[model samples]
Target: MLANLLLEIGGSMSTLGAGIGAGLAVIGAGVGISGVGGRAMEAMARQPEIFGKLQTAMIIAAALVEGAALFAIVVCLLIAGNA
Candidate 1:
């Protein structure tokens, strides 16, 4: 009985951790993308001639951040499923 109870608790904890990790990953990605956009806009404002380059760089950076977040979320879900 005790073992079963412990096992249940462990599973719950793992699920909770996975959820938290996924949430954090999403939040981090949002922050990263925002920062990239903000910086790119600032740079464009300061140097209008480089707007094209800045926009391209910003999009690339945002995409990378999103990809990482997606990967993290998938890993978290897998962990939760296993748990």
Candidate 2:
């Protein structure tokens, strides 16, 4: 099913794996950032005085997740191109 579709579209196992890896990376990043945001909001609600600190931490965590996702996507693209 899904494997057959990926095979037809990617033409090689390496490409298919790369595609799946890239997608998973992006999805993981999204989940990570959302969790950071949601938790930050909850913390801010509980301790309004520390809102600024929570915001800064949230931004940093989100940036790290985004950077890792971008790196994963680039590696996947390289693998796909080479294949």
Over 1-83, each residue of candidate 1 has an lDDT whose tens digit, in order, gives 99999999999999999999999999999999999988888898899999877788889999999999999999999999999
Off by over 4 Å in 2: 1-11
Task: Return the lDDT, model 2, position 53.
Answer: 78
For model 2 the local lDDT of residue 14 reads 86
TM-score of each model, in listed order: 0.97, 0.83
Model 1 spans > 4 angstroms off: none
lDDT of 2 at 69: 98
Note the Cα lDDT for every prediction shown.
0.95, 0.92
Output the lDDT of residue 33, model 1: 93
In TM-score terms, candidate 1 sits at: 0.97
